[model samples]
Target: MAMQLPTCTGIRIRSMSDAHVIFHAVTLGILPIVSRRLDIEERRYIHSGCVCVWEERSAAGEGSSVTGIERWTDGRRWGPSRVRDEFLYYQEKLPEFEADEELSALIFGSRLIKQTYSVFVDTPTGRRKWHLGTSVRLRARARFYLTLICMAS
Candidate 1:
């Protein structure tokens, strides 16, 4: 399925539902940054609401289906200069920690949507990494949290 996004410059991604786990692993995998890298005195709010996903059958009689996920502007319209500034800040700070090219690209290029920072991750079998143990652990943790929420409610 196709989704129209807001008219703003920023990063957009198309990946499986488990993308957040990858982000979490990457963020916690490295040492924390003691100093803030952003120069903006005001904290820009990040709001993600518009999300769409659907399946499209391949026309080649392959019976294949593809899913798309996208997240738009972080609630604020950052101008060109601001986008560049954020990109540079991350670029400078990324080296302080250990991150692979894919992670770095996702983080640094997250603010240059104008013909840049486009990432496509394939989730099909054999195309992506599958950490079964980690996945199970995370699922158990999530279930525990959800159970707590349900009990509280």
Candidate 2:
């Protein structure tokens, strides 16, 4: 609903009761750096929480619906300037990801919110990718890990 997000610019999503699988698939699909290429020095964190399905939802309801919300901030800064570009690229992709029929279904169905995100980066010879995504129903743990991948191109 009325989400007063962290000062940092990011994407927010809501998933269904069993949206773990879908969310992860969608996230990994976007993480260009991770899905296509990967390297070491890579660690992704996932935090799940609940939030309102509607933009008008309340904060009281958005209590960590995100099951896997991590960041690539470190990768953005320490990696290469191209890495920062990756972050910006994915940050811009959030709306499209959320617009997917499947994503909309999971988030709206839960009545419980799911928030996940990450910042992307295109390092030199090496690349770093990180993003946080939430799934209400992580019945499958893979959903948790996969959603943490880059959510941008």
Candidate 3:
């Protein structure tokens, strides 16, 4: 089930079906970044297949997954320094905008807030708890984003 990854030059992932390979690639490329954070440049890299996820086996035969941008569209290898430079470049290029506190809260809130509300329950106490948890999460998230924004500024 080994196949050559077109995006990762001279590298092949062993014992992976086509579906697994594609799943890994897509997950690696998209899951880490929120959809709202994805810009045109990120979309271009994703659609052009510049991302790769490969499995590496340790000496003890335990396998681990490695995900990264192995190469650029122009076939240049993305070493650690290259990746860091690209990240810094994008960070600098981000346009300044008024940060929406509520939106930032929703984005950064814990999944526990959603799970607590998702349970099928009609008790007033349960509803109250859920609302309380949601508010706390949102407030914490707002504070976190504010700190980051302040540091960046």
Clashing pairs in 3: none
Q: Give the lDDT ranking, best first.
A: 2, 1, 3
Candidate 1 least-lDDT 10 residues: 128-137
Stretches of candidate 3 exceeding 4 Å from the true structure: 1-3, 7-49, 61-153
lDDT of 3 at 152: 100
Off by over 4 Å in 2: 1-109, 120-125, 137-153
lDDT (tens digit, per residue) of candidate 2 on 1-153:
232222221223433323333334434443222221112232122122421111111133343332222322312112112222212211111223437888776654433123334433333322333443332333333454466664541
Judged by lDDT, which candidate is best? 2
Which candidate do you rate higher for lDDT, 1 or 2?
Answer: 2
How many clashing pairs does model 1 include? 0
Compared to the true structure, candidate 1 yields what TM-score? Answer: 0.20
**Residue-level lDDT tens digits of model 3 in 65-136:** 222122223212222221221121111112234659986545435211110011121222221110000112
Q: How close is every model to the real structure, measured as TM-score?
A: 0.20, 0.18, 0.18
lDDT of each: 0.29, 0.31, 0.28
